[model samples]
Target chain A: MSESETTTRAIQVPILTRVEGEGALHVRLRGNEIEQVQLKIYEPPRFFEALLRGKPMDDVADITSRICGICPIAYQMTSVQALESIQGIAIDPEVARLRRLMYCGEWIESHVLHIHLLHAPDFFDCDSAIELAKRFPNEVKRGLKLKQIGNRLLEILGGRAIHPVNLAIGGYYRLPRHEELAALVADFEWGLQNSVDAAKWLKGLTFPEFEAPYEFVALSCPDRYAIETGEIASSGHTSIAVEDYEKFFYEVHVPHSTALQARKKPHDSTYFVGPLARIQLNYHTLTPIAKQTAEAIGIAPPCRNPHKSILARAVETVFAFEEGLAILKSLTMPSRSRVPYEVRAGEGVSATEAPRGLIFHRYRVDGQGKVEFAKIVPPTSQNQAQIEADLRQLLPQLIACDDAKIALDCERLIRTYDPCISCSTHFLNLHIERV
Target chain B: MSRVIRRVVIGIGSAHGQDAIGWRIVECLGRLGIDDVACEFARTPLEILDRCEGIDSLHLVDACIGPESGRLHQLQWPDERIVALRWTSTHGIDVPGALQLATELGMLPTSVTIWVMECEGNLIEGAWSSAWTQRIETAANRIARTKARAVRGEIFYRCDRTSGL
Candidate 1:
């Protein structure tokens, strides 16, 4: 294994094709020296920004929701919030609560998909959940039911699973009945335990112990751990309002990819988002149940380890469901589902907590309520650079493992970000290279 | 006698040559919402043929570009004309290649019925030109019933699984 005698090797893991969107990982090696690692995201350009032009503000939520089926609510909420912002309307707290219910469903569904089906198999040495079902049928079934319940909650609220077509600009076309909310509450009784078990299960997995200090940024509220909206903060101790996203974060385009990888402004450094950050930054604001589970797992405040993120994600899933049911319980039938707003030609900024991370939408509306310009910065695009940075740090240990082991592990790590390659490209192939 | 038919209506067209044909019939069938059918909107021949596997029967409605603008041609495969035309997926997979792979894998559909719309829209965009648009309901109903009958083993057939749209 001497450097002089060691051979230079290169392994190119091109974007794994045919799942959701497109992304790839390229890493090079000279003997044991890991030379290069690039998370190549090559999704074809879809002119979402261009497409938004001239579309009525009313249609923004409906149209942009198609951006990614997995996090449609995020797009819908951001679009709606942006439209509302243009008209100088701060929606009712009740409206925001309902939105949280919708968002919780997304978090539960998405986190279950990732923590169990997509990411867990890598840790457990299975091909997919299809395989995991054999040895752990009950566990798999639990995961499936958990996922179905989330989707059911979404369908009950929004009318469809993949893209809930019912979410309008101001609010829903129709609000939920008391019975529906009660039904969701009853179903969540079982959901809570499943989420707790999921967290425990993930906690037992072998995690590579590494703590790379990152500027963990997420929305935090003094009252509650904000999901959809709040003031943003970083572990680096800087805070910004949602309106200052473009000011604090910057997007850069590289020649190798269509995605505009993002970086923190001024410092031009990498930051992390999603579970570990949120749980770490705002552990105190978690609901009693979430806090109990965190305490049970011995996940104290300021949890810094990234590998234990699945546990954090699971905890968030529980939080989303509990919060959703609570919202449903308090919500009686409203006379009108939406409060109409006429456009006044203004610039607006909207950010929502997507299943993955913060989702941003900026729009300049025309006097006629038509969008003149639009910019959608989805979570996946933001996570792209951070994913690369993590890979750079983690590659040495990753390559030390056997190739297959490392590839699957890399896939799991990538899934942790829940990178919606489509949100980035305009896309993704998930490829992993080990050298 | 009980299971529902999965109408897998595929629309294929290449706008430049005989490419406009698939789209014409697709518009007609989309509204129909045939029960027990998994009708998917597609352009590539491979998409149509590959997805059609394991079905007891398939009613493929597509357009044939060039001189046949409005002429509706009914094709029952095991026919040379039906076998000759290539099928390719959007991801660069051809029909014949797919069939070969299917044959090797033993996954060909039990029966496949194809309908070709003779069209001349050059497979380009704006080719809503289905000469059969006028004949759509009748054409669709005719094939729908034909496959329906064949799938259920109507008079002279015996399929363990009665299937079609």
Candidate 2:
């Protein structure tokens, strides 16, 4: 291929690396005027919802936890909440506190993993975290240490870090000992300070100037920053009941991708979820330290720039650590390990703010307490259409740049959302065709 | 001064089809009740770094898509002619890449050995193939015996070489 021939034609990245799962990106151009941008996800659907049919209500949490390795607690929490809601089981306040702590562990592990290992490298123009570590050893080490602490917290409360076996339909199989919870206090104190420092450190990184008008969606709680559970809240002040998710947001099948794209109805437009959405909508409810960190970093709400999501995630990590420490300090043994309940036929729906965004789980149980139908809406699928929309808005400005540069910029934009394609249906091949 | 070797056996695989061999082997080792060696299950290769930290020796077992079915291939780290092994998950980091990163980050174990069983038949979420059941059992017993020997101060290096079944 001659130099001019290469310069005039397309750019193709057969596979997208670093991001979780399989996907491809295709960009079609008509002499510098971009024709189309497609973020194609080709990972075969695992049929998780279909497979849940006939499974007992007791098995829902464990089964759904297999959806993603990174955020199993989110799956377990959502499924457990749905199952409990179906039976009209209101958990003990102590049990609720423990669940929130466990969820914080997940948020810490997942956010640290993405910020330091997965997404941070993109900012420094490195291939992987290993390469980034070579130059910034101290920062990488701090991140890994924070991650280890998160894993340890999970191990203590949930029995295992990957897929916790201790969670049950109503609550945990057994309540942890006071000593067990107290042992983590010292480490969590360090972790809280470390997270604050990490956020400040990430605030100093260079971010590309780009922002899209996004309809942010997340769970909003009246009391605290929502993580474990809340109603589906949108930036437009639309508060939809968890059971009413289908009425507000709908998933549509696109021919180019196996994962379904979700859009808010009535307007029928794409919306954003995940860190940026959560922080913007619930910044007031964040812990005092978290709010201070956000302010110190100049990350006040209404954050439109996707790249600043790294900062948002770090801020949330601080909140997780602070909340975890508070929960540990106020720990009390529950009167009962779990609320005893008889399972009856009913339908239940729940939505929790996962590390990425809002994860909704709806299940219809038969009279025999077996799952009749299951529907799960992960964050990545909800962000797919918005990702494409962002690319559409950003690509025209970069029309004169080389194809490779445009492709990398596109990848950086997608990673800003920390899209877990594994949880959704998974990328990404990049093809930029010029006609 | 003689250094004490802390050994860990990690079985890496999913419940998908023939891939369950790793979990099966780890279960078999657990049945042996070995007090000196630790046995763990890893859902993905990227978890290997966490499982291997501070360990003196490591043994990993997994099924692989290779030339021959129901056959075992043994590989040791630091070998110049190590065959490139690719993990099946596109979502998680591959084993070799993760190990390389671990080494760079000073997290890799002192010694590493991997046992890969060639997979056959459907690679779906189901039962293990009957053809490899006996092979898995034999490999598990061998690994157990190796752990017993190592506990007895037997320092064996490059003991099992790859051979066709």
Best by TM-score: 2
Candidate number of the best lDDT: 2
Q: Name the fnat for model 2.
A: 0.26
Task: Give candidate 1 misplaced runs (Cα > 4 Å).
Answer: A1-6, A13-20, A176-182, A298-300, A398-406, A423-435, B1-165
Best by DockQ: 2
- Model 1 chain A worst lDDT window (10 residues): A424-433
Worst 10 residues of 2 chain A by lDDT: A1-10
lDDT score of residue A367 within candidate 2:
84
Report lDDT per candidate.
Answer: 0.69, 0.83
lDDT of 2 by residue, B1-165 (tens): 956667888888766577687887888777878765789888767678677778878888887775566666667775544434334653445667566667777777767877777766566654555756677777788887776776676845553344431
Estimate, for each residue in B1-165, the C-alpha lDDT of model 1 and write its tens digit: 877655566655433345544554555565676667665554444334346656755556665443645556766544555456644232222344334434434445656566765545444455444444575565666656665676668722222221120
